[model samples]
Target: MVAVRTARTLGLALALCFFSGAFAGVGTAQEKKAEKAKSKLKISVPQDDAELQIEGKATKPTGTVREFETPDLEVNKAYEYTFSVTWRPNNYTTLTRTKSVEFKGGTADINVDLTKADPKAPDKAVIRWVPTPDDVVEEMLKLGSVKEGDVVYEPGPGDARMLIAAVKKGAKKGVGIEIDAKKAAEATENVKKAKLDEKIKIIEGDALKQGDYSEATVVLLYMGNEFNALLRPILEKQLKPGTRIVSHRFTMGDWAPDKTVPVKGADGDEYMLHLWTVKEKK
Candidate 1:
């Protein structure tokens, strides 16, 4: 009986040891996973009160800089960090800027200075309000085959000439997005004057940040090369297959147009119009 009791106690001890070893192994794996899931980000701003958003979530700033840990990220996989900063330097003016960066699972730092103007940044003033002549606008619409059942979108539509003409040409709806507040208001007024207010809508906002253009069957552009390039990715990503993009006087970088045509403007000068159709994804 004594020998049997000793054997049973030994067996219990071995079983407890085995279970404890298994639990320890699991704990080590969990620790390693937690380490891989976190990344560090530090951002410096020009002002303490400047509002900042990291990955679309507002992050509080401490003094001129803020450091925080990001949420779970895949190990060694790069992720795009999209952030925006907004601040006011004076009572009359407010400024907002958005930028993006890519980061893997590691530490990253960025500096955003709103006090100094970015020389490379595309300016609305630089684009110049060159309205497509009435006849040229007609040709552009015709090139895109704008007609009934089509929804047309024009970005930076200075006075909304393109949208106005498109609606008059038989488009189901026309949408204009202008970055300049004054331009947007003027466009709205023009739409009302044309008595197409019900068919056209003018939005006052940055085209890049507006984020939705899937409803548009046709797009009209009269912006410069820089502006067109800036908008290229958004158009490619958001526009649906077979959507037609028509541009006057400029082209997106290296993206060959499906067709190009020259038309004489009412001003007596010849202008070029380019058209592209979004192809189905492979």
Candidate 2:
């Protein structure tokens, strides 16, 4: 998990497990005041050196009950979290666990016992893959109002065209999480070819699983409706208020978007784009 942000960003902070960076907020007074009282998470297992990494929020811990605190979180917001446990003595076979929770602003105890589920379970793809074109990416970023200081992330960044475009459009940084190993390599190469090797980071991992976009200001998506539906609760819980989400051709089941638009693709095909802003859960 190396980052253009800094090589040691993850090496030291996450012990070469996962690496990421953060951005400061300059927002309305209410938003500024909400940046305290983080959610509390504690993971319990038999291993004292169990490396625990959660989804969405980014602070990996190691201990019997790996305890950590999240950054200021939205109240009544549903977020998806993943617990990635690695027992080095066992040859580093990773056990990944995912859960969705609605936390009110404050220190909510999220105690997870990883012993319950099989630590070696595999994951299934949640969405059929579809790549977003560069022009369509431009439209989505514009639709989401991606600009300077924004950090963009695409969960299933196919070839990373979306992130490459975000960096070019003045976004400070971009991250792409691709589940396919070959595509992830292809994306890394593409970013390098774009000379955005430093600005864009790629991860070859499960997109429908635990991963953090906590630093993201704008998130772009191109999954199907059901996939969006499955990810909606987690998105709402994990993304800070005011963060913009734009999906290329699908909408969250009943969570109406703030705006929706259609853009004609270069191939004479039309695509539907839906934009949603994370709101505090009522």
Candidate 3:
């Protein structure tokens, strides 16, 4: 009887071990499956010396990484990351700006090429404040064929009227940079009064020195001929292909416009608008 009982007890212990091992294997497979469901983030930069920082109130980035993984992030959830990149483009300019990027799906790719990023040259802020009238704004948009979801940027946005108008005309977003503090403040107030604070953003900074409008799908300029000429090279290098730029009463030096038209303003003054679409560089 004792031997029979011993054999039965040994069989029960062996069965328990086998079942526990099978369950453990399933748990390991489940962990591996969970690992595969996490998302990934990748950032590409021109130089190894370049630095990229994702700026948020509680957010911190490790460094300029070629590959990053978001194992904790929920699947299919989109997250917006604003980055400040400081890099010397071929030892050119130490460019820095707060720019946004949307990360979704299983992977996110961010490419940083400052070949024409921000013209962060330590030059004096050349302020030639030329305000664009509402009629001129309308004409400029008409000339550029501004459409919905277009990003409009005005470098020397005097009072941000151009940006506000662009937003009103159905552009997705508008950004205005003004060198003068008073004008920037006024632009802010004007945007607030128009109830366009959500759609238009005004930056109190130098247009000549600050050059991160690379996101602009349509650039509206009211600068002088000389300023526009000086800014031509930077715009050419930075702006993406098929991007449209329109200037009031000025021209981009050697790079000729796709079309130039004369529009009479509500004030009865004729304005010369020049539109240029960025093309492949030779």
Regions of candidate 1 where Cα sits further than 4 Å from its true position: 1-126
lDDT of 3 by residue, 1-282 (tens): 111111121121211111112101122343345532333345555456656553322222334444434333323445454445555533213444445555543444435333234444332325446567887889899888888999998887878888888888899899888877998899999999999998898898877657686898999987766567567767877898988999988787777888999888888888899999888878
Better by lDDT, candidate 3 or 2: 2
Rank candidates, lDDT, best first. Answer: 1, 2, 3
What's the TM-score of each model vs. the native?
A: 0.58, 0.56, 0.55
| Superposition error at 204 for model 1 (Å) | 0.4
Alpha-carbon RMSD, candidate 2: 17.8
* Model 2 C-alpha lDDT per residue in residues 1-282, reported as the tens digit of each score: 211222122122222221132222233466555544455666686577754555433444456766655544445434444555544333312334443333444546877776554424442334435677778888898899989989998888878888988898899999988877888899999999999998899988876576687777899988666456656766777888889999987789988999999999898889889999887767
Flag the better candidate by lDDT, 1 or 2. 1
- Worst 10-residue lDDT window for candidate 2 reads 2-11
Instruction: Find the 10 residues in a row with the least total lDDT in model 1.
Output: 15-24
Alpha-carbon error at 198 in model 3, in Å? Answer: 1.7
